[model samples]
Structure formats: structure tokens, C-alpha cells
Target chain A: MLKRTPLFEKHVAAGARMVEFGGWEMPVQYSGIIDEHNAVRQSVGLFDISHMGRLMVRGPQAEEFLQHVVTCDVSAIPLGQSNYGLLCRPDGGIVDDIFIYHLPDEFLVVINASNREKDWQWLHDHTEGFDVEIVSRSDRWAMLAVQGPGAEALLIQAEESGAGSLHDLPFHGVALSSIFGYTALVARTGYTGEDGFELFFDAVHAEEIWDKLVGLGAKPCGLGARDSLRFEPCLALYGHEINDDINPYEARLGWVVKLDKGDFVGREALVAIKAAGPSRRLTGFEMVGKGVARGDYPVHTLDGEPIGVVTTGMPAPSIGRPLGIAYVPTSLSAEGSEFDILIREKPVRARAIKMPFYKPRYKK
Target chain B: MSHNVPAELRYSKSDEWVRVEGDELVIGITDFAQDQLGDIVYLELPKVGQVIAPGEPFGVIESVKASSDLYAPVGGEVVAVNGDLDASQEAINTAPYGAGWLIRVRPSGDEEEGIMDAAGYAAFCEDRAH
Candidate 1:
């Protein structure tokens, strides 16, 4: 049985097409993927991201425990700041990509829904020696992201809490603000590569806040638009881009892995992997011929030799072109390299290109 | 929501509609199919004079969500193709039965006899939607 979010009935009433995603019956589209995607790019769009796991880690050893588990330097971030990081297995394979928010008393680790249980177990197994309390707030808290070029304006207009100027909040900053008569955690972070705010509040206020935002001319978007928006920015999905077998180095996320930081999970293996150099690297490619190269499609060389596999492929709605991310041999990872994506057992012409297929227009 | 099924047209189980004009038949995907496909960006149509077998794939239509094969409702030689779709594929979503017509074929067999009529096709679509 698939779980439903707090806004399930709201989505159905809005004529949204619901599909099972990450063990949850989520809305894939409301007013069509293209329209919702365009709304996020040109105006503002809202999303129900309540399915994401929220873990609260508190205690004296909180920062120390987090630094040991995550690849990013969590200790470097001050209070009310967030940093994107990755959790890895001892074998250097990614466990999951996460965003950690540093609050006044505790750290909030937001993770992908599909990896919630596995990540909790991984973190639990490593907490034998640390004096920390990891509490799962997955059911108690609901998340909503208001994203796009005009996101700040919509948020400020919709916020009824008399909160101070939200524009003053720097990127990746977080604040405890009163919204809709409830205390809400507003973070200047999002996966859409646009200027946005992710609001976290009690699950009971989910519908009220969502309705307030929508009433302010914010388009209600779904998972379909979320995927397209993130894809254009070349953001990695957990299972597709950084699974248990795909390391961060090969995923072009070496910057997140602080090898210089003293001792962490997967540190030794990553050092060895880095020294050996990744044999296969994830690269972006654009379809020069026809057809969308979907996930798991075989990528072949110009001479018909199979080199790599496509991770995520789709028509980039923002760019108005078909683009994909694939893992190919390091020799073929350069831009302008020609290759073929086997769609329906037939090789289709494609060429390697720079990623972030569409340049994100984020407000700095 | 209910789909639009014209009373004069015959339909295939794959959501394609066939309109017979004497010996020639005009083929296009139904409004239901286009709505399901959503935002079609490209259409691959068979060439004029190309012979197609009944129920055989004549071309492919791609949307941002999925790619669907455009099958021939009946065996025939393609006499006309809608080249306008090459420039504006949104016709499939806007005017699927008219401007979005995929191909015109001269029948070589009585394949239309096995197809469902308007009422039967509407029932079929309603059943599948549930």
C-alpha cells in the first residue's frame, strides 16, 4: 500500500494526475507538466515536499556525529545555515544526498523519502558511541517549496506572520518565522535551482499554508515539474545519479566530499578512488537526432562499442530540447564528443554537452 | 472526465481514430490519447507511398512524458502525411482529430471491420480510464 501525503485529497480535487513515487501516492501533474514547469521558470510555483524525511539530531555530540557521517563539512556551517552534503557507505558508494540545516539547538537532516528507513538505519548503526538523540519527524512536519524567479515576492505577499524582510535572508539561510499563526521554519533552499523558500511547519497546517500560497497567485506544481526543474539544473536524484554503486567523484560531486576533513565514512575508499581516478564519469549529452533517451538506456561509442549507461534523460522543458545525464568512459566525457543512445535497440545520434542544460536564473 | 468520440469515426483499442472517406482513410490519435501523452514535442510520420500493414507501427509520437507508437488501423499505402505537425506538434493536443491527422491511407484490406464504433470505443476508453 502506498502512503498519501497530508495534501492528497487537495491534489485529487485539483484534477492532479497522481502516480506512485518513492512509495508515496504523489501528484505527478496538476495543470500539465509543461505549464507547471513554465510557471516555475517564468513566475512562481509551489510544491508539496512533505514526503521528504526530516530527522532532528540533538545533544552535545550532534555536530561531531554529523561531521563524521556526511561528506560535507557540517561543522563549517553556523547556526541558521544549511549545506548540501552526501552520506556514503564504507565502500565509497553514495547512501543518499542530503541537506543539513543547523539550528540553534539541533541539526535537521532532510533526506529523500525513498531512502528514509535505510538512511535512519545507517545513521543509527554509527551512533553507538555518540551522545545524540536522533528523532524522526517525518510524520509530524510537512514541507512546501515556493520556487522561481518571482518566488520571494509571492512568499512575502502570502506570509501573514508580519515577518521581517525575507529578501534579507542570504542563500542557504534559515529562519524561524511565524506563518499563518504557526511557527514555521523557512529555509532559503530548494532543488529547482531557482530562488525559493522551503517552509516547514506542523503537518496539521499543510492545507492552510498551501491554500494561502496558491491564493496569492502561486501555481501549484507537482512532482513532474519538480523533476524537469531539477533536471535542467543538473541536480542529481538519489537513485538515478548517486546510488549505492555510483560514487560522488564519478557523479561530478567531488566538491561536496571534504577529503581534507579528518576521518569520515567512505573516506579511505574515496581517497583510493580519487587517487586511481574515476574510470567512468557522469557527463551530459543532447540528442542530435530524435527520441528521448530514458533511464537505463545503453550509451555506445561512435563505432558501436558500448561505453556507459544513461542515468536520467528527458526533454528539458525549460531549454526546449532533449538532454540526458549518462556515465561514459572518462575518455568520452569531454564536451562535443559524439555518441549514440540506443533507444528501442536502435542507436540514435547524440553529442556530449555541458550540463545544467538550461542556465538557472537564480537571484543572488 | 469523458473523452470526445465522434459518431462517424471508427476506433482502435490503441486509442487511434479512423475516418473513412470512400476508399481513403484519415488516421490520428484520439483526444484521450493526446491528453494522456501531454505536450507532444515531436512526431515521426511515415513517408507518402509507403505501405503499412494493419496494426503495424507506422511512426512514433514523443511527448515529454512518454513515447507512443502510431499504428496503422488498416493495411494501406500512405497517400498523405501531415507535415504541419513537424513544425507545431501541439496540434495533437489542440486539434487531434482535424489538423493533427497523421496520415491518409488507401485501404488494401477490410481492417476497419474489426475496429470499434463510436459507442463501443467510448465504452472501451471509459473502462480503461477506471
Candidate 2:
């Protein structure tokens, strides 16, 4: 049986179409993709993100252990802040993209649901000498994302939280607080390209907070809208954009690879990768022809020579046009460079465009 | 099971529906098919005057998350297409039987042999559930 989140019942009650994703039965959509997607873009929306792995790393050598395992400069992260980082193999291939939240006592490492077991095992394999303990907080917490332009006002209107005026919380900042009388770790971070907050609270209170948020006009959105929201901003999705065979540089995630921080896993290979420059680059494109670009579609040159493959291609709801991301040779990845995407054996014309098809609306 | 399967129309196990009108066969994907592929955003149809074969793909449907083949239940020469769908494919989700119709075909006579009644298709769709 596929695993269900704490809010699974809520999703079913609202008539969401359930689908299997990352070994869990998740709600793909409720009120339809376009409607929910526009809801988040134009107003506030709520999402159940409990299916992701929630973990805590603590002990005397916790910081050192993380600094060695992840590519980010973990030592630089102050308490109440988080850093987006990646776990890489010795060959610099990406294991997963993670968010490391530096709390007062422990570090909260949020990982993808599909990579949860593998990431946990990877962490354990590296704990030979480090005086640290890795604890799975998945069962203890239910995660929710309150996102969009109006999210701040909704949070401010809510009662009883030590975070004290969400407007004061810096981007990527976390605060241990009480929300609606329940202890929660509220973080000003989200995957959507908008101002939002992710709350980690007790699993038992899933319905309580979810209902309250919905009552307060936060439209209940599902995975379909969530994927579209992230797609517009070109945020890297694991398994599609990044995988064990793809390095951070190839995935356009080199910014997260802090090599100067000294000797993390894959540091040797990443240093070489950065020096030599990546052979292929991840680039964005807009379809000029009449076909919707689908993932895994083969890409060919105008002369019919196959060059690369598409990672993600679709009609973006926000952009009002068909856009996609693909890994092509660095030579053909520049702006105005044209390629042919073979859709059903017919090559459709596409032109490489500047990345981040849509600008993010995060609070600066 | 709640999907609308009109009894007057014939269905193919591949989820396409056939409605015979005079010498022409009006075809569209079934409601069950639209539901299977949620929120159809794009539909690619064969050009008018093009020939098609039964059980072969004559079009493609791209939903929000997936892209699937739209097969021909009864093949013929394409005479007309729902061109307005090029801008808005959501009609396939909202009105799968009417405006969602893909192509109007001048039947090739030998193409309707393998189709089933609505009850048989509903049963087939139910069987796949388990």
C-alpha cells in the first residue's frame, strides 16, 4: 500500500485525484491544475507537504558532520536560518537536493520523499567517526506550506506565535513558535516562486491547522499546482533535473556547491568539474512550433542529428506559453540557439531562451 | 465509473468514442479518457484531408503531468477538426463528448468492426480499476 500523509483524509474529502508519487499516494489535484495554479499565483494557497522526509541531526560534532557530508558551507549558517544544499557522491553526482535548517539545538534536514530511505542510509554510512545522531522526525511532524503574495497577511492575522509579526522574519529564517496554540517551527521558505512559510508542527494537529487555514481563505492546492508553481521559476526537481548521474554544475546548481568551505564529499571531483567546466549545461527554451513539449523527448539538430534530451517540458500556466528545460551542449545552449524537439517522431522547432522562464516573487 | 458514457456512442478499449452522422464519423476521447489524463492542455490532431488507420494514433493529448496518444477508434479521411482547441484544450476535460471532438472522418467502411457498446466499455474501465 502506498503511504499517505496525515492530511490524506482532508484531500479525499475535497475530491482530489490521488496518484502515486515517491512511494506515497498524494493528491495530484483537487479543483483542477489551472484553477489551483492561478489561485496560488494571484492569492494565498495552502499545501500539504508532509510526504517529504523530516530529519534532525544533533550532538557535539553535528556541524562538522554536516559540513563534510553536504556541499554547502554549513558552518556559516547561523541558528534560525537555513541553507539549500546537495548531497553528492564521490564522483560529484547528485544524491539529492536538501534544505538544512539550523535550529538552536539541532539541524533540520529536509529531503525528498523518494530519496528519504537512500539519503538516511547515506547519512548513516558517513557517521563512522562523527559524534552525531541522525533522528527521523517524519512520524512526529506534519509539514504545510502557506504560499503566495498574500501569505504574510494571513500569517499575521493568525493568533499566538513566538515568531512575532511574520514580516520581521528574514527570508530563509526559522523560529520556534506556537501557531493556533500548537508548537510549530515556522520557516520563511517555500518551493513556490512567491513569499510563503513552511510550518512543521505535530502530526496530530494536521486537521486542526489545515482546516483553520482553509477557513481563513487559503485555497487548498494539490501537487499539480505545486509542480507548475515550481516549474515557472525553474527550480530543480530531483529525478527529473538532478539525479545520481547528474552533477550540480550540469544541473545548473553550481551556486549551492561551496568548494572553498573545504573537503566535503565529492569536493575533489567537483573541484575538477568546476576547473574543466561542465560538458553539458541545463538550459530553458520556448517552443515555436505547435506541440506541447513533454519530458524525455529526444532533441535533435535542425539537420536531424540527435544531440540531447528534454528533462521537463510543458505549457506553463503562468507564462501563457509552452516552455521547458533540457540538457544540451554548451555551444547550443545560448540565447536564440535553435534545436528540434522530436515529438512523436516529428521534430518541432524550439529556441533556447534565458533561464528562470518566470521571475520569482520572493521577498528581498 | 461516474464518468459520462453515452449509450448511443460506440467506444474503443483505447478510450476513444465514435458517433456516426450520415457518411461521417465524429470521434472524440471518452470522458473516462479525459479523466485519466487530467486537465488536457494541448491536443494535436491530424490535418484535414489526411488518412488514418483504426487502432493507430491520429492525435496526441498533453495533460499537465503526462502526454498520451489519442487513438482512432474508427479510421477514415479527416474532413474537419476542432481547431479552436489549439488555444484552449480544457474543453476535452469539460465537454469531452461535444466540443472535445477531435476529427470528423469520412468513414473508410472497414473501420468500425472492433468497437464496443457503452456498457461493455464501462465494464472494461471498471475491470482496469482493480
Candidate 3:
């Protein structure tokens, strides 16, 4: 049996297409994938990201414990700031990519829903000596993301309890603001390439806040749009772009690894891996001939020799073209490199292209 | 939601509709099939004069969400192909019966081996609606 988010009732009432995702019954689309996708790119869209695992790290050695496990430098971030990081194994394989926010009394960590139990076990096993408390708030809190080019404009109209301007908040900044008569954690962070705010609040107020946002011309988007929205920005989706066998170097996520920060879980193995140079890299390509390259499809060189597997592939709604992200040999991970994606046993022509298929519309 | 299964035509279990026009037969995905495959973006149609085996996949149809093989409902030779779908395929979602008709075929063998009328096809669809 699959679990459901707090807004499950509201989603059903809206006639959404519900599907099982990450062990949860989630909406795959409402109006449609293309419609919701265009909403995020053109105006603003809202998403029920409550399926993400929400964890809290408190106690005296909270900062030290986080620094020791994550690849990013947690000590560098001040209160009310968030940093994107990754949890890796001792062998430098990615466990899961995460976003950690430095709060006043505790640090909030957001992780993938499917990896919630495994992540908890990994984090718990590592806290043998540190005086830190790992608390789970997965069920008590609900997360909503309002993203797009006009995100700020749409969110600025929301009922607020703060006196300062939201535009003043820096990217990756966090604030405790009163919304809908309750204090909610509003973070200037998101997975989509657009400028957006992630609102974390009590699960009971899920429908109230979601309704208000949707009533304010914010399109209700689902996981389908979420996946496509992140793709145009080249954002990595765990289990797709990165896995237990893929490292930061090969996944084009080396920027999140702060090897000089301190002694971390994967620091030693990452140093060795970086020194040895990556054998293959995640490369982007566009279909030069025909057919959409689906996931797990074999990619081959022009000579028809199988090379690697496609991680994510589809017709990008924003770019209006069929694009794909795949792991290719180091020799083939170059611009203008030619390859073939076997779509239903037929070799279709493709060529390596620059990533972020469409130019990201991020606020400066 | 109920699907639109024309009473005048026949349907296959794979959700393809066949319209008998004198001697030639018109083929296209049914409304249920198009609804199942939302927002089609690309389509690979069998060429004119190509041979189609009964119940065998003859071409490919893909939406933004997923893809599926277009299995022939009857054993025949492709007489015409909808070339317009190669450039724009949204008609499959908007008009699965008219403009979205995929191919026209000249029958070669028994065409009623596994096909069903509108009433039988509607009940067949009802049984699969979980």
C-alpha cells in the first residue's frame, strides 16, 4: 500500500491523475504535463513537495556532525542560509543529494523520499560519538514550492506577518514568516531552475495554503512537471543521474564537494578518484534523427558499439526538442560527438550538445 | 470517464480502431488508447505499401509521458499513411478518430479473428478499467 501526502484529498478533488511514486500516491498531472510545465516557465506554478523527507539535526554538536557527513562545508553557512550538498559512501559513491539549511537552533535537512529510511540509517550509524540529535519530521511538516520567472511576484502577494521585503532575502536564504495565520519556514531555494520559494509549515494547513496559491493564478503542478522543470536546468535526480555507483566527478556535481572543508565521509575516496581522473562523464545529447530517447536505453558510438545507458530522456517541453542526459565514455563526452540511441532496437542518430538544453532563467 | 467507441467500427484489444471503407480499412488508435498516451509528440508510421502482420507492432507512437508500439489490428498492406502526424501529432489527443487516423490498409486475410464490434469493445474496455 502506498502512503499519501496531507493534500491527497485536495488533489483527488481537483481530478488529478494519481500515480504511485516513491512509495507514495502522488499526482502525476493535473491539467496536463505540458500545460503545467509551461506554467512554470512562463508565469508561476505551485507543487506539493511534501513527499520529500524532512529531518532536523539539533544538539550542541549539530554543526560538527553535519560537516563530518556531508560533502559541503556546513560550518561556512551562517544562520538562515542553506547549501546544496551530497551524502556519499566511503568509496565516493553518491548516497543522495540534499539541501541543508542553517537555522537558529537546529539544522534542517531535506532528502529524497525513497531514500528516507536508508538515509536515516546511514545518518544514525554515523552518529556514534557526536552529541547530536537526528529528529524525523517527515509526517508533521508539508513542503510547497512556488517556482518560475514570476515566482517572486506571485509570492509577494501572499499574506505575510513580516515587515521586511522578501526581495531583500538572498538566494538560499531562510526566514520564519507568518503565513495564513501560522509561522512557516520560507526558504529561497528550489530544484527547478526558476527563482522560487519553498514553504515548509504544519501539515494541517496544507490545503489552506495550497488553495490560496492556486487561487492567486498559481498553476497547480505535479511531479511530471517537476521532473521536466528540473531537466532543462540540468539538475540531478537521484536514482536517475546519480546513484550508489555514480560519483560527483562523473555526475557533473563536483562543485558541491568541498574536499578542503575537513574530514568527511567520502573525502579520502573522492581525493583518490579525482586524482585518478574520471573514466566517464555525464553528457547531454539531442536527437539528430528521430524518436525520443527513453531511460535505460542503450547508447552507442557511430560504429554501433554500445557505450552507456541513458539516464533521463524526453522531449523537453520548454526547449521544444528531444534531448537526453546519458553517461558516455570520456572520449565521447565532448561537444558535437556523434552517437546512436537504440530506440526499440533501431539505432537513431544523436549528437552530444551543451547541457541545460534551454538557458536557465535564474534571478541574479 | 467513458471512452468514445464508434458503433460503426471495430476495435482490437490493443485499443486500435478499424473502419471498413468498402475494400480498404482505416486504422487509428482508439480514444481510450490516445487518452492513455497523453500529449503525443512523435510518431513513426509504416510506409505506404508496407506489409502489416496481424496483431504485430507495425509502427511506434509516443507521448510526452510514455511510448507504445502501434500493433496492426488486421493483416494487410499499408495503402496510405497520415503524413501530417510526422510534423504534428497533437491530433491524436484531440481527434483520435478523424485527423489522427494512422494508416489505411488493403486486407489480405481474415480481419475478424480477434476484432470486436463497438458493444463488445466497450465491454472489453470496461473490464480493464481498474
lDDT of 2 by residue, A1-364 (tens): 9999999999989888888999999999888888888888989999999999999999999999999999999999999999899999999999999999999878999999999999999999999889999999997899999999988888776647534567888899998777888888889999989999999999999999999988889999888889989999999899988999999998989999999998999999999999999998898999988888878999999999999999988889888888999989888999999999998899999999998988999886
Error of 1 at A198 (Å): 0.6
Every candidate's DockQ is: 0.65, 0.67, 0.67
Give candidate 3's root-mean-square deviation (CA, Å): 1.5
Q: For residues A1-364, write the lDDT of model 3, one tens digit per residue.
A: 9999999999999988888898999999888889899988889999999999999999999999999999999999989999999999999999999999999989999999989999999999899789999999889999999998788877777748445456777899998877767778888899788888999999999999999999888999989889988888899999999999999999998889999998999999999989987899999999999899988999998889999999999888888888999999989999999899999998999999998787766665
TM-score of 2: 0.96
Candidate 3 ranges beyond 4 A from true positions: A162-164
Q: Report the lDDT tens digits of candidate 1 across residue range A212-301.
A: 889888899989889989988899998888899999999999999999989999999999999999999999999988788888999999
The DockQ leader among the candidates is 2
Q: What C-alpha RMSD separates each model from the true structure?
A: 1.4, 1.7, 1.5
- Which candidate do you rate higher for TM-score, 2 or 3? 3
- DockQ-derived CAPRI band for the predicted complex in model 1: medium
Local distance difference test, per candidate?
Answer: 0.90, 0.90, 0.90
Structural similarity of chain A in candidate 2, as TM-score: 0.98
Of the two candidates 1 and 2, the one with more favorable TM-score, higher being better, is: 1
